[model samples]
Target chain A: MPTLRLLAILQTDCPTCRLITPYLNKLAANATPIAAVSQDSEKDTSEFVRQMEVRFPIQRDPGFALSKRLEVVTVPTLYVLDENDRIVRQEPGFDKTALNEIATLLGLAPVATPYDGAPASKPGCTSRHLEVQTEDAAAAALDLHSPRGAKASSIQLADSDDPYEYCYRAFGDALPVVPPTAERVEKMLRAAARDPQEVIARIPPCYGEATVEKIAANAVMAGCVPEMMRVLIPLARAVADERFNAHGVQATTHFAAPLIIVNGPVRRELHFNSRQNLFSNTARSNSTLGRALQLILLNLGGARPDAIDMSALGNPGKFSYCIAENEEENPWEPLHVEHGLARDQSAVSLFASEAPHGVSEHNARTARGVLKSISYALATVWSYRACMGYEATVVLGPEHVHSIHHDGFSKQNVREFLFENTGVPLRCYSGDDPGEGFAQRGLYKEITIDGEPCYQKFRAPEAIKIVVAGGTAGKFSAVLGSWASGPRGSQMVTYPI
Target chain B: MPTTLVNPMNERAPQAAPAAPRLATLQGKTVALLDISKPGGSVFLDRVELLLKQRYGVTSVIREMKPTFAKPAPAGVIEKIRGADAVIEALAD
Candidate 1:
């Protein structure tokens, strides 16, 4: 015997739909199980249920995502699917004869005096789905409901039950997350302004396909608003870049996290703090945007703490470490402009780095003086005497950026100064065991400058990326060392938002 | 009142390939010793290699080390180890 399912697609705003709603109500109340799919907001759908005395479950289409897929051409399109979910019969418009046939098919007595004191037949209003003619666009529009263009299932829970517990059982990372309700995901999808089924990239470890809808689910869990989707979508793509080494980063024993820095006009639009408490939990966009990416990696990529993510000592940044460049406060070009993106274009740069260590230069007034203190802080990147030729980010506070600029040093000048000054001497590279000594001495790495094989600090001048952020009151800067700087580990990736 | 919630997990089961046939004996066989690069791994594998050569009469021994202890080995490393009659890989802490 085939399982029975009846779906009635209707719009409360349509008059012909209102005329045929009584028969739909009768079928719902007495005949069989029916779900009324309404192409309207929940408020309007609930009002329609009350006014029309509808007893069936009113499923909110919210964005018309389901209506477009069912190809509802009119206001009153009805469908009945069998055990295999294949449509057995479809009825359109208000017809008394069609109502009688539906009642008989549902194993009810044939309708006697159907639509009493009503017209025999009436044409329904055109479906809003047909308003968009292109099939590809229409299909893309439905991605919020069907992520990756696959069939979706929504489970029902008791209203008295806690929603946070529902997400924490399996899809959580030791934190209570906002439930990724269908309505919430739909709103997030619309904010992204892209196809929900669009494949951003395949996340590593588990290598799960990260569709826009799936990514939005994670974003919703992170307590992100709809507008934050604009930032999170591009961010979801940045981790998938091979240069970022997200695969190795996930499976590594090294303490590495995806460090993100937002630049250009979007910082202000999203209210990212480029000033005081920039790296702290000062802005909703900054914190949740970073948290959303981590949630995506955990839920979609399956990079759990005890599983593939084998960080020996995971950093607090594993929760979230995102900050925007203080573009207006900085004297030099913003971080994105250094990466060749136009200053007007909003972009995000992803770096695989450790937690930040503060570098204080309170007494240093000149550029070289500040650089001297910063080089020691930079020298502690991979190891104090290791001299690892890896990348490091120098987050210059607003005061330090101005102090360096006032001394006539550009961002490149500062990077070059750090590179030339930071090194461990040949005499200091010795220990008990030769093999241990070589590994500890930052061995097998040397840069020749002025006819001297000086064991240099970084691979190149640009290895020291200078990002100017934080407030102006402090004479402090921060250094975040890289995990592994080349193909050996993750490199920095800049994605235009 | 009852409310409906959505399931946020991948419902599809993982697709795993079938295992290879078992080997009967180790005599005159070329065995591979793979180290995951973890601490104390080489010491354990050294004793195992010695036992295979002296007691089991293994012909040749192949050795390989994973790039890092964190991730799985590269495809080339796996193919190299697969050339042996039998392989012993460590899971050291």
Candidate 2:
């Protein structure tokens, strides 16, 4: 049975395929036998057929088997085959002259003209089968294990649809995210070396189960390299710790977010930025690691800004706030070590805090002088009149640390000095004012400083935390005010990585 | 063939729970006013307590304050409020 026919390989999203639809219909109307192969899902293929008013018989190529077998590289590839299945003529894209020539060969009048309001020629989209090949290559390079047993739900995307746009619309943080394709997620899961179905933590508000697979997907979206999974695993546990009060942190109408501080050998190994512009987007490790946690909170935990996250004046740190302790330049033990972890051990400390307030003391040359200037700023934590209930972190710059360390001030000495020296003058509180101040609450102890009566700021020296960071060139330090302190509020949690 | 991606969101289907039965009336009933411990939450609840007593004849108004406003009500607080015929919670910022 020898019969000549035309074969067209197409995908719904290719513009060239849509452009050539009318010409293909014209040929079909001319009594030409044609078979069209659609490299798309059944749903998408049906829509294309109905919308384009396709007159020819079309068949679905599941998994792009037919396109792969035919070695098709570009979509809208038209082939004129003889009765023996030998190619007589082929066109890869839309070309009016080529279509007219093919029409002439079929003993028909010209089917295309310049007045068609279409381009004379247009390039075609790559065949869908090629994407699988590229993904397979990447998987092999990463030595990824089987993803068949993955537990998370899967979404199918047509080859023509923009994956980035689809991801943004579906699960974005009002910013662009990397598409969490199966291959990329699998790579992260394999690196984690943990069961994909293992539940790390249940995020609050929605209490979504953050399985390893889901976290990997979010990490992929946050643009994290696979190596960061080790840090992220324990970090997730810290967020879910009962003492952290994640439910309150997520739902509160206050400026509080989990600030991650990385310490130990992993900081150097992962190249986390602990130097100049400590909190800026200078390092990929610092930026992506922080972003991954936020994505996890937003996607897996469902703490969407418009929904559960009701911070009145949302802090910028909600976007990404992570830093490594500059242990090399630090005069005191790193924050994690001070909290009882070994110096060599890797750990992540989570604190619920507001944004950093920079303090400039370019004129101070002694530890006493530096503490006095920082104390003035520290006096305003939580509120100018409120005291004894808040906590703060003093991110001392290298230059400031140098001055303090040169004066032989130990870390404890620094904490004690800040606690005693920081206060609000009693004269600042008016008698007509309500009971917002500690003076009215009967919680204040008056002390004289420079012959002026003032109320002490923090209840204890331990309420102030200190960490060394930033460039040695600047005398700038920063103070991060805590959301709330003690058992009732969020307590800083640290977990070893 | 279509491209497949892993779902990055929490995939658990949300379970539907029945809402609590509504109170028939406030008169001659005990009401619980829960102040979430925010700065102005107590003031809001104070007015609510006054209105409930003056307008609805609510008796035995019990006032409860959470340790902090940032978290859910503690189990003890929830149990205490469970005894009330009606409860009003203030969510002032």
Candidate 3:
């Protein structure tokens, strides 16, 4: 007699699925007995397993491949496999009473694991699962449920019992979505003036076609309004810009991306928070717009985490890291204006940034004095180590900005001042222990300065980039360092929307 | 017309014989050592070069480098590799 391996593929939300999983678990617990799974409602299935204390392995098939392969048209399908893993008995929908009959055929004892399931954890304001505010709740819920490409007409609303909600939550998408209703999407589609099918950006090596409509759908999912799409289209173009190098940013194990910096009237027009918590999720414009770009990158460009992006420790920035420049506070010209764009024109500048390091100081009273403090803080090896020919971005808060401005130094003067002071001495660049294995690798070279053998040190002054950002409250400045030196240096590229 | 169920015997392949062992031919091949100018990248290439020189007598080496490590590999890198026998990329540390 051969052993039976019943692969129970069931949906977690189905009442019938919940009823039969325990018995199936018992069937699978034996050596070469069975393999039961709930492909749909993975959250409920995981919760069910935790609650029932089912020790048997229950694989989730979100892609619905295994279900389609076994011709499973219904939930709780049990496929009895022979010793060679061939399906001998295939049946859709679970039946606990049939276990005895099926057990006799396979010659196995029915041993159901005792139910000792854990309760659901209390939801709190942990960074992972922050609740959407009530005002934005309806829209956010719709965004998740009727994701952009979902059926346009009469989009299904997520009720308390919607299985899709649980599925979305388990997949790390929130429980609800503001479905892109046909009425809303059509309005947005009309704003574009191009055919919905018109291709905007060609996603790399996979060569997936991303049309304007598809990008609009993703924008809808990210909770972006249609007018934002004006900015989105060009921003997508910037990311796909051959020099922007989206492919290398996505493919490399190192940290890099297209950091969108908004300048001119659009920052104020879109209500992009250049103020308090500018980089954080305080403002809808910053959050959704940044999220829209990331979703397009993840879904359209196919730069999924751990797949194309092999970041050692991927940061929150990978989700979405974008901000607006505080143009009003700066004494010097705006970033776009500095890059040759008109002062009145709206533009977006893109740069590849590493995660930012926050430097806060309270004792400084004046701008140049504060920058000296900031320079000391910046020059400190912990936040940023000066690299030859590499660039770092300094985002200044309003307090630091006001302090610097009151001292009568222009932004250019400030940038030059930072460049001159924020670097370690030439002696420190040499390896303290030259006998170290890495030092012996001949990676670091020595220079004969004035006929004496000394270590080549001091990064070029242009490497330090100072840009003003943040709220009007604290005396804090954030520094984002360059991961590697580039041939073109860190030149800012701008696109006017 | 009736469908005929005729079984065709194996005529192309002779009676199953033990397959010959396969070996990689990396000897006497001119290998290109390309660098992107990053410290770790150059170090990794040097190690590969050492192995190729010490173990194998393939001494004809061609070396080139991209100006900066952060940038993409220059246009000629792939063409250079395409002409060689096998190309080993030292991506990063």
Please name the candidate that would achieve the greatest lDDT relative to the true structure. Answer: 2
Model 2 per-residue lDDT tens digits across residues A76-110: 89998888889889889889999999877767799
Q: Write the per-residue lDDT of candidate 3 for residues A1-497, one digit (tens) a residue.
A: 66556677655445455545555555655664566666645565666666455657777775666766666666656677887879887655544346555765667774321111101111111111122233421211101001012111123334543533542442233224334445556666777776665555545423333566666766776778888878877776666654555666676666766577888888888889887788888888888888877767765676677777787776677667789988777777777787677899988777777777788888888766787766665554322233344566788887888878888888788877775656443455356643212332233335443354533222544556667888788888887755443434334457777
True contacts kept of 3: 0.01
Query: What DockQ does candidate 2 have relative to the true complex?
Result: 0.52
TM per prediction: 0.69, 0.73, 0.61
Per-model TM-score of chain B: 0.85, 0.85, 0.58
Better of 1 and 2 by lDDT: 2
Question: Judged by DockQ relative to the true structure, which candidate is superior, 1 or 3?
Answer: 1
Candidate 2 displacement at residue A450 in angstroms: 2.5
Number of the top DockQ candidate: 2
Q: Native contacts recovered, in order, as a fraction for each? A: 0.47, 0.92, 0.01
RMSD of each: 18.9, 24.0, 25.4
Candidates sorted by lDDT, best first: 2, 1, 3
lDDT per residue (tens digit) for residues A1-497 in model 1: 55677888987777667767766767876748788888866776776776666768878785688887887888788888777778989988888888788777777665534113234676776787665353332111111111243323576777776777866765656877888888888898888888776656557667666777777888888888899887777787678765676777887777888888999999988888888888788888888988988887877677899787878899899898888998887788888898888999999898888999999888888888888888878877876655555789999988887778899998889989999877655555656743322553435467554454557777678889999888989999999998867755677878788
